[model samples]
Target: MNWPTAAGSDSRPDPDSEYWDERQETRPPGERRDEIIEKIGEQVRYAYDNSEFYREFYSDVDVDPRNITSFEEFEQLPILSSDDIKQEQKEHPPFGRFLCIDEEDIARIYGTSGTTGRPKVFGIGQDDWDRIGEWHAQILWSVGLRPDDRVIITSPFIQYLGSWGALAGVDHLGCTTFPFGAGMEGQTEQAVEWIADLQPDALYGTPSYALYLGETAEERGHDPAEDFDFKVMFFSGEPGASVPSTRRQIETMFDCEVVDQGSMAEMTPWMSNSGCRHLENGMHVWNDIVYTELLDPDTEESLEYGAEGVPTYTHLERTSQPMIRYWSGDITTWERHDETDCECGRTYPTLPKGIYGRADDMLVIRGKNIFPSQIEDQLHALDDYGDEFRIVVEREGALDSLQLVVEVADDAETGPDEFHDLVRQEIKSEVGVTPDVTVVKQGELDRTQFKADRVKDKRELAIDV
Candidate 1:
């Protein structure tokens, strides 16, 4: 089957309306399901027909993509992992067998951040890129960005797709955009100065960078809340935007709303699984474009609402490089469409708490499972907590040691001894782990203009030895 054309722009929703596409966003569950199932069937058939990877992978398991009709049948298909992508790319090079469109038709190429090893490459066709742009425009509109609003995008223009998608959405919505990318020598200070000078209405970047930007503004002797004109801040690449403590901190610092949203880089329209301006505590999974299934990590069984599971995703619209049942390693609790009470009227399933951190990032110390976010939530609750902190886990002989290197706010009034005891007591009482708390003065800890890697597992060094 030939790849389909982009959804017509003539039917695009009115920019000034309350909902981006009221019909699509607020459709009843049964109606949406029927539409989604049909699309899934088409996508599976197309992938089997056009992509060699899908044909081989499915055929090996005796699963025919053509026969897959329901979610139940689709679940029988093997889950795709990052390792699978890495191996395929290594064998096939560049786009691998996943590239369905002709090489000349490839419009854009992006990849993973490559923090660990070689990044996984993704090829996108012009039609797919157009759809991604439209999806994001709908997403950004859900968060109340008007056509006339001025937006400052702080994401670095690398292989990363988050910022690029945001810029596309901004353009589609007719908003004035300043692509002030981040991660340079003095970009933070310069970006702060630009914000002060221009007073842009909206900003997009990682949640950690937004907090760091507030600190940078303070260093420049400017109060962020008073000096900036940001009405809303959209964040991704981390969970801080949805974390209660971190979210409140940014909101109080900038006097604006914090909208937390993100998606896997392989799954291009990063904002497809995002929160609207009116949705609190969680984000809506826009299933029309991307279908997400929460499954038990161990058993691979589909999880019901209120259960914690890994978000396995399938692309319904992507034609160039489609991912079916791709595993997202992050952990989060979700609610069914009818279970959530979103005032925005969206019927999509809600992630009551945004992604809790990667499953691999969870630390098993002293037989107690600990998430860095649990510690972050604890620290940000403290009145004297600074903007930066790091969690270090090391092996001490046979037992594991968890040490928290935290920073005290510059204007903190509490004594180091008293504050240290308070931090230790809080974590022990709340998180069920007694940690060795090392307190440093503010600005002593390293900062990032992107996703902050707060955890350092030194236990690996011991293993290597």
Candidate 2:
């Protein structure tokens, strides 16, 4: 697919394709590691010299940016957290001192999700914008997207990077993109009808919204698989599309291959579970652009391949807002396989098992740690409960209690008492905690057009009020 560029704009290289080939051709993981460290050293030195934020951060550390040799020495530098970004923006107002380029160079602006606090504003210069577009193109190609295909993107197009990145990638692919950006307005319905009338060959959005569209189509007696001619589904923003049961449900409803693409607002789109002929291993890391390290969540020590822990990332190509040894608050495991031949023989380093779960998403309830995925897995195992559910955590008499509110098929002929008992017993067996289970009426809970927030912690309300 031809990469997209504006009129008179210099033609940008297809870094995605180049990245895929370069990663596969690299000797061993150790050799790839050495190369990554060397490249990152150069970027770090540049950022330290040009960006004032990094200069002050490293001023007291006494390590010369030029002399910093190994990743271990790099780790000796203090970790940059989202709080640091927020504090910097708070002190400086508007854009912080991290900008290496002048204001005129910036082509786009975006903000963080602000799940923690006030959203931190970020700017992408013209060059960085082009780099982001190239990254998206690579992601699209990796997930089997083609230029001739028509795809509907249902993500919100505000200050968020995901929607724009997807649009740019589709444009790069030379695909006929139906920019059906988020919100279930008249336009969304129109977009669905447009999809039906136009019969886009692919779909993109959160898993929840995709399911909602499928339900809408079914209500109109139009099966998405039979009528829409959708061949592929690309999903992000949540773990649903990557989870086995959720992925199966979406694929079954849409009759397409469901692939998971992962990225953050701060970091460029770098990793994804694409169609590599094998497809069963983990997601492939774009090692050329971003270097990844798996660390023990508790000790913060680096782990070997196949070890499960939180993911730390270093952006190799980012010149605007450089992130070096940034902890990405997500939990995952990596597997290194030496399979040389496959249906698609591009040999980049693969994850084998996709992202396990988010480190921040895990909850410590009743002295036992549990993840939403654990609850999701148990719920999916039960045939009586519907896939839609939420986990509510609250303190009951000084003890933390979890409530599992699930939707079930109305025609199942099972009462709330029976369903409650089943969930309580099943959760006890699986999670070692007997959670209070409530069977909500089907369609009672609110549906989302974006990432579904399944876990809600209400513990703050019990602060002696």
Candidate 3:
């Protein structure tokens, strides 16, 4: 299939909305700071007025919200960590004081993906949900998705924000949606049938799950690339979509353009960042709606533009539960855009590699810091290996032994030992650490319906909150 031409637009990229500076996405950083500083003060004051928890937390910090005039001073107000939110909700039972909406106005309540720990609950009012859908449409339309397209969502639509927000986006564009919930007994076969019957132009699912569906379609005597008329493959909830090799593999299997995204449950499913036509591999942060800062993982200081750090977030427009200075442990790096222009001509800030790793998931093995995304990148680049693989970490006496257990192709030209040696040498060369490589036969690893269990760290999980 051919890559789509730059095709759609959203008027949301305005020059100004809030006090003539909300258009920071298109303006230069130096010019935008003044307005951002103003909004920061207003946001803190709004939180202090609307949420009791913020008032108490700020009171404990012995600081006045009125005195917070700059970004540094605003950051000094204190960080709202995920674990802290979870504990507060536990103490308060159900929703906590962090919520900005009243009980009567709460339009919907959703739980976190709970991938890392206990799921933190979040809510949205009617207006909040509308804004989310509208913001999502901006990204969708920016990436060439249009109203006339037929989209099929394979993600679960219960209380999870992923499925719900995706459908909301389709609504924003007035696109037709076929909600095929995930993990149902005959979901795969049924999805294949729908692809054959309705002929959708787009699909929404996790990267691994989408890859598995392509495999399933082929296994059930159907040619995925031939039968499917898909043009866009929108993915989130995992790292595979952003990895170069994985992107290529999925595109080849389904014959579509892959656009990756970054979002979290507590942050609300507005899709804070998304891929645009300009940077197919990189995702642009919705600076107009969300303020994202990368902080040095060790020092907690803001990292330089090119430096990799954890993404700390603030929901600029979210009213139900505005996450002000929520320290997200997810690791990434970003770059500012200029009028020099992307292929699509939008000047939004871009995450160069997207969300590659998390600070909490970092592994120290044989004096080298490793992340599951690195191993995943290596596995995807290998032509003979299948999409499924897992990273296993075991304690070998005093030292931790790292093993990359990957699956080899069914019709392999090289023996298992030779393939293993190649992977070992390549990983050592790329990641600067030698790893034990085990080549399993095809279909040895588990096929996941959602996020794949990539890193299995059997060593004691001691991560400080």
Off by over 4 Å in 1: 1-5, 8-12
Per-prediction TM-score, please?
0.97, 0.89, 0.91
Candidate 2 off by > 4 Å: 1-28, 270-277, 339-353, 413-418
lDDT: worst 10-residue window of model 3: 1-10
Give the best candidate by TM-score: 1
**lDDT tens digits by residue: candidate 1, 167-250:** 988887778999999999999999999999999999999999998899999989999999998999998898898889989999
Ranking by TM-score: 1, 3, 2
Per-residue lDDT of candidate 2, residues 2-29 (tens digit): 1122322334335334333445444566
Better of 2 and 3 by lDDT: 3
Give lDDT per model, in order: 0.87, 0.72, 0.77
At residue 1, candidate 1 shows an lDDT of 24
Residue clash pairs of candidate 2: 24-347, 281-352, 282-351, 282-352
Candidate 3: tens digits of C-alpha lDDT, residues 317-375: 56677888888888888786652235654556778688987777888888888878888
Q: What is the lDDT of residue 119 in candidate 2?
A: 89
Each prediction's number of clashing residue pairs: 0, 4, 0
Q: What TM-score would candidate 2 get against the native? A: 0.89
Sorted by lDDT (best first), the order is 1, 3, 2
